[model samples]
Target: MSRLTELLSRIKAKDPKIGNELAKEIKVLSARRQFGLNFERHKPENVELANREVRRGDKIRVLPQRGSTKNSDKRLWQVKDTFKKKNDHLATIELLGHDVAETQVVKVEDLIVVAEFQDSIYPGLISTGKVEKGKDKPYNTVINGENYHALKALTFTHKGKIDAIYIDPPYNTGAKDWKYNNDYVESDDHYRHSKWLAFMERRLVFAKKLLNPSCSVLIVTIDEKEINRLGLLLEQSFPEAQIQMISSVINPKGTGRALFSRTDEYIYYVFIGSAKVPDKVGKGEEKEVRWRYLRRTDDESARGTKKGGPAQFYPIYVNKNTHKIEVIGEPLKPEDDISKIKNINGCVAVFPIREKDEHHMNWGLTKPSLEKALSKGFVRVSRKEDSQIQPYVFSYLTAPNIKKIDNGILYKKGQREDGSWIVVDPSGKSSRPTTNWNEKSHEAGAYGTSLLKALIGKRKFPFPKSLYAVEDALRIVVGENKEAKVLDFFSGSGTTAHAVMRLNRQDNGERQCISITNNEVSADEQKALIKKGFRAGDPEWEKWGICDYITKPRIEAAITGVTPQGKPIEGEYKFNDEFPISDGFNENAEFFTLSYHTPLAVNHNLAFKQIAPLLWMKAGSRGKRIQELPERGWEVADSYALLVDLDKSSEFIKPVKASKSITMVFIVTNDDRRFQAIVRQLPESVEPVRLYESYLKNFQFTIE
Candidate 1:
């Protein structure tokens, strides 16, 4: 038997519970190898946290004793307890507040992992790559790093604030396409699925935290390879969410394969809390009822709904001999009796067919409705299939029917007795989209590839996502909130970012997108690159990674309206023809690489400086600087202020209070006692936000 078959059989032969344990063993080892366990002090840095190891060692600030405070963060540093390991928690010599270092041991809670951006790589937003900023709109952010830690960090600033989470994770196809810990999980591997699941599960747990559980949509796209598995995972992970599946046609010409040609992919919609899947309005064609609800089937939202359309409650006259609706009557008032209403044309009054025998009470329109529908060629006269009943009136929202409906207007408007009602126009009216999708814009080559190539030059990433597809999915969830915050953890070639930019440009919305991707080259591929005279950790090696060389550059190009070669682009608009064909979108974006500062001990002062970029991002990249701190203390801005020193805390507080525009102040202090003290002293108008320490506890893992 084949090795895979044998492995499958062996696994199936064992109890699923036992096999599950086996998978856990691999997971534990994977976690240990991917992120080293903190052994200096065996108290376990992330023992209580999920998917975290140790945080930044540099953000530790030494506390100078003015007087004794209530919250000294004794948990971070203290006299070495003979009963406990001394090495487990200890700050660097620079962080020592006391002259004597023998008794000082840093508190476990105080040793945080701070994410310091590589200044040489990021250096802040690119001058020319800035998307045009409108008042109060947040800037888009693209993070080039491991998404797991990125998501954990987001839980600090964006927890419970995100409106949508769209992800297209690795498909885990055995083609060595994706990596786990630095090693690619090739197709021949027996545990490929297990590793991918472990990778996804931990990140998803953190992602769930970033979402606004009360009103948010979780959208996931995948193909046949792992669609079923992903669906089950989403269901299990988000049990409270309403799960829905959509089959989207990506390839009109099926991908010819051994079994069959695969023509479609799927999108899973997990509507959490008050979130909903809205109705999609299509081009106004009356005859084509492919996906839309026709026949005025549901009494709700129908034409004559209660007080919805009082004037559209009239009857359409039907002739018996010809089965034609030759005349339409005036609508009756809501107060008029249905039994008393009659057709003035000496024909049967046909209200929008409601219940059997043409329930007249629920007709969708009045005389004007009939006249308009007739003019638009929407009304039809026919009987149900295989029936000898009298013909009825049919009105469609779109084009005429493409296929036969059991209760449809009969194709054969057969011979009728004298005075029969009859009416017919070209029977085609179109409405909105349905679950079964067939659209050309969704075609990858039409928009996905051609558009991405125009922005990035060559096909940097294979089978990139279509911009229209992502935008359409996002548009439905935003409802009225145009400036929604969107998170795309697996933002392949930055299609989601491109889509957000296009949407903002079209509607002048202020939506912001946070894209996180790992810029890691697999170990197996490093050997190959080395033969090409390049080594890992070098600029050339980074070019092989997706996040840095492809995703970030693509984002820059898309936002700056330039090609990857830095040339201005001029082409036809892919989705909208009315919009001018232009170079890249004029949207602004910032790129950041994930790097952590792991000092021997904490450096609170240095951390204060490093956290400015993060603060800028959290405040929607408000102004360049709110209050400029000449040396220490805080700087104030319209959206937020940064406070560090107790001496100038009052200086920070005064202007912040008078501004009336600032909503948050980032308090930078290692001592919990001081942190609480500052919180107590801050004005009620502004909320105190702590950085690095809390977030470090969640994302301490390093990407090797």
Candidate 2:
């Protein structure tokens, strides 16, 4: 009769063990509903501190031995002491399990320190190398480190500034493609989906902060493996943004064990704030351009001498053999004789005359304007069949057609031999892209893998996205923004950077891309290294990581027009734009490895050298970074200024106003009133940022 008895009666009807001996001790418990995605939210994520040195009290784990069994030590340890023993560095460590005091000494080279997400870290960037084709261009950056830490650091440098974020994260194919808690999430792992979602959710939270608040986009590419789940995850993660999923056929030949061959993947575009698709044609959506005669033929008054202006009565000359619009002559007076005007080198002169009445019709544009149109290839010559006075007719683009070309509604295919422009109306190109896409260039095998192989000379990465696929995604979102700042935290093989360069080359844009990826070696390589008595942090082992082996080299090859081996790249890039790879791109790029620092060192203002790049990036990555502190307590670069001394505000404010290009001033002081007072003295165009406090608050590990 009680609630517990009522619950017991329901269970008794469905269970054979209801009245059994084991069921006698069973107690009724309340049930809670899990309506949506549920995962182990408290599960700790370990980040291996390969670049940091081993110190006392640091958490550590021993590298797997080659001949070790499955029962190898997976427990965590704390370093009690570190010392040199007989020419080898050793560390005394104690077990961090079940209050155990078991202690052991191991070679420091054989150990890797791991940091949990909850642990506080002061992150900095160390420049490893750079490739510059010109001095004026901003460097496209590539960071070799764990992406989570990179994104955490980006929250300070790039928050609310990125115009586009294109990421091709691991699809969690359950084939050891991704890792969770330092181990691969194999197909048999029961919590692989939950772990993948948790992993993505943490990074997406940071990604949302890095995107521009007023206008930006987040593009994620995924296949059937977790498309539906990823869709839901994105919706939950970006609740305030507009999200749309597009089905793109990356592989025409399906690869799957199911009845239906899986040939396509999906792309999620999260348009935030005022972001919208540009009015430009996408791939395979071009229409032929239709030309109209320049003469005003609709109204009779427009053709008469009374209404037509004197300057509009001009003659457009055409080559007799080529039929191309060669020259545009001065306008003749209404009383002047047409027969007296001399011909030019056998070229036929055609005037805007009515074919039916022999009345002088004015041109749509004046003589000077017609000459400018001829230079742009907007003027064309057509053969007239019925006209007596003139055997040829002059045709030109209407005002609306010219407006379309200027607005990017029409695409210029190329110029004709006659120096005329060939424009095509990309039908629906300026409209929103459809949900489904099937294009040959989007084929991964043909364009993605093969193209990368051609660029880097081998298949080092597993599966890179088709360069055109990334290019289209970026062009659709940031096409109108010529100087967009793009970021890709999961930029494996550096495809996003390559795509950014391709887009820049297409329109002479200045879009800078920041790519972040870790230097993780492949599974097979890891096995070989362990057999050779080499651990992860060793130079020999770390050199084979995805960043060093494939990403950096591929990006360098793409920019240098030569492969890693100094050989010229072998093929031509084909798609929306075509060019020989050997020509390379007139762009610059810099490579940096994410480094960790002690909070004490950063708090004392000793980490300025390491944090200089972040300031440059925050200033839109405009010019060379100011790598050192100035004696005057202030320094100005091409795009930003830094004021390290509060007393030097009077001097700093003068140069900043004179340097019209400087847009950001980082005043390094903790006093808000002083900072605000200094900001008021500066030009309205310049943004004042408080350093130290602003920088330290971002690294407090708030998001994780």
Candidate 3:
């Protein structure tokens, strides 16, 4: 048996569950070993004494520190008794005015510090890059030397800052598309999911700190394959967030000669808190039918009273001279004039009008309501001058015009006589969107498939979401709030960015997007870039050097807002670089320097002594004299002081009481012991002094 097989057998003998769980891993590793494929595994050389030595029954805390400079050589410092050593690998440290648990382990060669305390507090950081400001620039300004992988470095700087996060990481199917160290994980690898999970877990821990209370994360996934597992993982990572499912039926496939075609993909929507919920609209069935009036005809006569017309009654008007019936109001328009008025006909029907005194009601309206209608000119009355007894007069009540309309058939589909499909205009005398998705007849076009076919035609990516679908989803989530920021780390063909730009143009919004992707290019990718004129060694070409390809053409496409087909839209794109602080400092100072300070206001007695001479040089060259110490204040001996008593001396020293000359001194020290010693030596008579430490160190200091 191979060495790996033997190791697995031993593990199985000890713990059957662990052995069974890790069996697949052993087989894959063994296969790779036999095939001579290169797979790199990074292990910490130093054993991370703080994490590996946890003592039995000891509870410890883990705080991770990242992006330290290589040359700093600064060892992790620990205060002896303040924190008890729980184990050879663990220590309980006090932080944030409380004792907390910290773990010190080297996960993938990254530095972590573990402390033990009572409460659970995850130490994560934010990414310190230049944030985009206004319309003048299309992209954010990324400060040089910011490490992209070091999440802990960003916590203090980026806490509660991110509005949204979208990431598309490697699928880790072991198709030579992902790396274990610098090498790829080929197909049949057993630890594929484990590696992917670890990668995501580290980033997610940091990502949590970056979110605002109302922030949300959108993770795009395919099929039932890993979505459930991913959901579980997310639950573990962000216990405070609520998980929502948004299943987009992007592509319905018609496959079986015997079975129904398959269509649809799912998107997982996870939100931070109560602030997140899926957008929904009301849905129900119609229960009642009602009629509304359209127009009124003349009250002069009720037509269609002839023999051929359906049986109907017409109120007759008596003439004093002839006692004949006549139409009252002006004749109806040609279109409105009906050939005949009928009662109970198969095709048309009419109802008779009754007087208030008649006591019989034929319509739904009340007698008082009808009277009010007559008062408002809705009903009409006619009178004849020559009419005999009872003053020949006629009153006619209008019909409650009925029109046959579709009942609950709100949505429609299919193309019209013309080749184009029919679209329901929400405001154009049509129904609004309803919650019953099955009722929606509109397909949103053939592009509804979750795996959007590449715009350039062939499939360059395994699963690219349709731009329209993303926009639709965004419309439901963001609605009219157009200025929201969007992030998508797994930016394949840059569809999310494209969708954001398109949505912005359509709505005239100022929405911005940030996309993070690896430079690992696949076989399909190289062909795509080659078509775009990307060549090796070009300045514009280096953008594509990372695991996620970034070429000049890709960026140009984003800026011009064009698809692979070359259609122009309104958008802007720019490039930026993220680096770590170590990149800014020289090698010697990179690791050792914990913080830096920029000069703000400097008091003579509190400023760095070494810097004082530089300030003095600048002040003296300008012909201004340094002031002397004030009266009634304690002073340092032999140091130049800013004095209020200018008349007493031109010398650096001033006589306070003969032989006891007083001067002002600015002391600068980084050593805690030295700083304390200087403070104790100051005379009791001296007033309290103001001291300014390095701004970087000051920022890192916790009062407690």
The candidate maximizing TM-score is: 2
Q: Write the per-residue lDDT of candidate 1 for residues 367-461, one digit (tens) a residue.
A: 56557656544555654332222235353433344223223652323323422223322344344346676678788876788777877777457
Best by lDDT: 2
Itemize residue pairs with steric clashes in candidate 2.
Answer: 280-429, 281-429, 377-420, 377-421
Clashing pairs counted in every model: 73, 4, 63
> Which parts of model 3 are misplaced by more than 4 Å?
1-158, 254-262, 278-462, 523-555, 558-704
Each candidate: RMSD: 20.2, 15.0, 26.0
What value does the lDDT take at residue 486 in candidate 3? Answer: 61
The whole-model C-alpha lDDT of candidate 1 against the native structure comes to 0.60
How much does candidate 2 score in TM-score? 0.75
Worst 10 residues of 1 by lDDT: 41-50
Error of 2 at 625 (Å): 1.0
Writing each residue's lDDT as its tens digit, candidate 2 over 337-416 gives 88888789978888866543455667778877778777777877657554465677566766788898889888788876
How does candidate 3 fare on TM-score?
Answer: 0.39
C-alpha lDDT of residue 103 in model 2: 89
lDDT winner between candidates 1 and 2: 2
lDDT tens digits, residues 126-198, model 3?
Answer: 1221212123323321111112322332343334645565555666555666554334566676756665665
